[model samples]
Target: MLNFKNIAIRRGNRLLFSKASFIIHKGQKIGLTGANGVGKSSFFALLRGELHSDEGEFSMPPNLEIAHVAQETPALDCTAIDYVLDGDRELRQLQQQLAAAEQAQDGLKQAELHGNLDHIGGYTAQARASRLLNGLGFSTAQEIHPVSSFSGGWRMRLNLAQALMCRSDVLLLDEPTNHLDLDAVIWLQDWLGRYPGTLLLISHDRDFLDAITDHIVHIEQNNAEIYTGNYSDFERMRAEKLSQQQSAFEKQQREIAHIQSFVDRFKAKASKAKQAQSRIKSLERMEIIAQAHVDSPFNFRFPAPKKLPNPLLKIEDADIGYGDKVVIKNASLSITPGDRIGLLGPNGAGKSSLIKVLSGQMRQLNGELHSAESLNIGYFAQHQLEQLRLDESPLWHLQKLDKQASEKDLRNFLGGFDFRGDKVNDPIGPFSGGEKARLVLALLVYQNPNLLLLDEPTNHLDLEMRHALSVALQEYEGALVVVSHDRHLLRSVTDQLLLVANGKLQVFDGDLDDYRLWLAENKKTGDEPAPAAIASPAVRKDERKLEAKRRNTLKPFMDAVKKSEALVDKLQQQQIELESKLADPSLYQEENKESLKTLLAEKSRIDNALHQAEDNWMVAEENLQQAEKSCIN
Candidate 1:
């Protein structure tokens, strides 16, 4: 368990968080969310002790371990199996120490070895290692591949595998689902749902989070507020909280207005002046909550354009692959102007490569990619930041793209991405992935090209920022081609879908989720689809109602689980303090006898409460399982 107390983060002169307090507990999954550059990742780092805040304290059990997974690690060199197996460092160390002792035939060390082996559950480490490796997206075949040979996305899978293999007390994941395919993501969600350790993950995948996290921590205007539930529940709670705040603010405003009216009328009467003044003083003393408005990062719309004569863009009999290994083969699709298109595909299905070919960054090997005349294109590549010059400042980078732009114009554009003043002057080198993506997007908005291509542009962005981008794209009068695994994003901003799978492009005229379901069907072994397989309308409605009922029934249990999570935090804190005192030999001395007794007593009480809470948590979980089963059948 860990607690972040009174923490503050700054980007240049701007404060990201101030005196924010939050706690993470064992077996709880917490989601950190906010707009881009609002310091969610920074907060994660602060909790992990990777980044220090300018003020306040972070407390955790001294022995509590944390594992953080990045999108990719450039330094990885071992095979994926080695990377995953390396997570069992403690087991490996113990084995080495035991082997050394055995070689020396030291009886005292042998007893220590047996005790350590028994404590670590050494007999089960290997089985756990394999099971975790599979759960986190690594197949047995791929595990033997050298990490260097893997793509950035696959390398990310290795990071996930490693983290799960470690089975640390807490997982501090930054965009853990960024590279995962739907199956892998679902597997991960299920794994986390059943996991006993604590999890704190930042992800843009809505369905994944909706299925997993038990708590949501929203960081807004330099503070954090905790909510209980999944992403959807968090959104509902956020709206309710904001609405409540607005109601309170309105009441305060009305009271102040009434008092002001009374003061204005009674000022001439000397006797009523003191009462009016006291009312005025009361009005002035009322501290209203600031307007908690969330303006997403990108929020611009393009002027509507005339419909295209035919398709805005087209691909004909294309083969997308490296060399002879074709992924998308003989694919053809037409995109109309002003169409919001979602590109769906599994990993290694050539989604990005196809987008690249369509956008003219890469040419097709065997087919023609045709486009309308006078077409202007804007592409948000996966490595859009790589296009930026490292030596240049944020403003300078913007200027590099358009040297004719004035400083005033450039600064205003950067401001849209939440960069301002000295932040605009900050070199590109230190900016986080979200910042870099926003910078690239800011330039794109200014350009306002007719054809926009986006490739997983939402991964690094937080909920608010992604919503902003979605709003902007939704309003844009252009042909959009977005390749992303984010289900919510696709649903929000896309009109239809162009699915790439089995070396082909299959266009679907429906919602993105429907298209996703279609893709899922294509991958399934069953001859009949779920929709077609259901015999009666009663069964279909019952199934739908069942799912809804299960999700609803879990909400109250989640709330109770959240309360127990708080208790766990307090118990962990008490445990840490007790351990610190116990570590000191002076506590056993007669002079410190009373202190020892008190500490021990407090520890015992805390331990008992923690035990009870854990039991309650188990019961809540069992209840949820029963509810889910009932909903299913």
Candidate 2:
């Protein structure tokens, strides 16, 4: 158990939180939330013993093993899988000792070290690390890739995998899902749900918090308060408290007004002067109740487009990808006025590819792409943040967009996004990622485009800003196509769901719940199957017949099994070749150490891939056998 007693913390003369008292019982999942610069990260630092509280005390069990994601990962010439496995310090130590024992030809010590390795599950460490990589959306081929080969976001994912690899009593994760897609986010949710440890998570994702956390620790007004419920429950409870506070404040204001009025009327009269003075004293002694502040700092809406085209954009039999590699093919889509679409798929499954094709950022490899003569597009992607003029202010950017607009008007518009006073004139170079994201959104919204194409727009947005964006999208009178990991935004804004998977684009007939089921099935099958479209009564009957048709139903499953088996066979053969090279005596020389390391890493990745492929094959075969039995019955 971790206990905090009247804790007070200050950073650079700014008191962040004071009188914070809370006890985190064993295995409690607490969602830590506050606005930016609210010391949430500082509290985490205090917990990790990197910083000490200015006053009060916090204590936890001395022997508890704490794990946290590293903020930075140095570029190292090591395989990603090996880096993840290194998280288990004890296992790495054992491996080191084992290697030395073998080098020394000490049979007894080698045998003892092997026993220790088995005891710690060191033999399966690579497989465990590989699973973590796969769950976080790394492809099989990428597992053996060098750590330095990945981009920053992928490096963050590697950091997350390393944290999860630790065997700890307490886990701390800050913005764990920022770089994940919807599918990977769902996978991480499941993984955290099964984690047998106390968790302190700091994230701006409301649905994610509600799904995984049982309690919320909110820091505001120099106080950290604990609430007994999920994020939704906490909101409800906080709203009620604030409502009561507002009522009390209003009643107190009425009394003060009455007292002041009486005092003004009686102060001129000698007889009532004493009574007025007594009332004044009473008024001074009464505690003033502050008004409730429920408003978000962000308040803005998308301006309606000037023109509404019947069909804003259309794609006919399009092939989308880069160079010669096709990510999605044979896709037909039509976007008209008032269309709201949310794309759903696993990472690298072509969600962004479709968006790129639609936005004209990437030309279609094949097919006809059409747009209205007067169509205007507002495209938002992560790279756009880097395109902003860092040396210029928000006001300058807005002025550049419209030279004739009044400065006061532009400042008012920027204030809606919380860029008030000096912030409006401050150079954007020092702005946080979230601020830059807000600025990009402000620019996009100001454009008033008939078609909005957004890719992961909520990546750095806070909860309040996300809410404002959702509200704005709900009121938007134009077509929208968005890809985001934020389920809350997707549920609130999107009216249609399009899935980008299996090199095809299709309308999903169901909601997010049904999408989850589809994802589970896809994971089991090792190949994505098209979801059945919404059916009429006659069509439903035909669908039943289709399922019962043994040959038709069993063929896909058999094919999947064969595909997985062939993949396993191919990987195993490569594994054999790598092992033969590794077995050569010359390969163990000092000059060949790097090559040996690469080969061993490849061998580990292949072993893990073969195991997964075999498991997939087994699942496919079992499903086929069950379908055949059903037909016979």
Q: Model 2, clash count?
A: 0
TM-score: model 2 vs. ground truth: 0.79
The residue-level lDDT of candidate 2 at 369 comes to 97
lDDT by residue (tens digit), candidate 2, 55-158: 99999998888999999999989999889998888899988997897689654465466557666666557768978998999865677789999999999999
Best by TM-score: 2
Write one digit per residue (lDDT tens) for candidate 1, span 286-376: 2221112232343344445544435778889988777756667787878777666777655555888988888888778798888888677
Please give each candidate's TM-score: 0.66, 0.79
Would you give me the overall lDDT of model 1? 0.67
Candidate 1 is scored at a TM of 0.66
- The lowest-lDDT stretch of 10 consecutive residues in candidate 2 is 284-293
RMSD of each: 16.9, 13.9
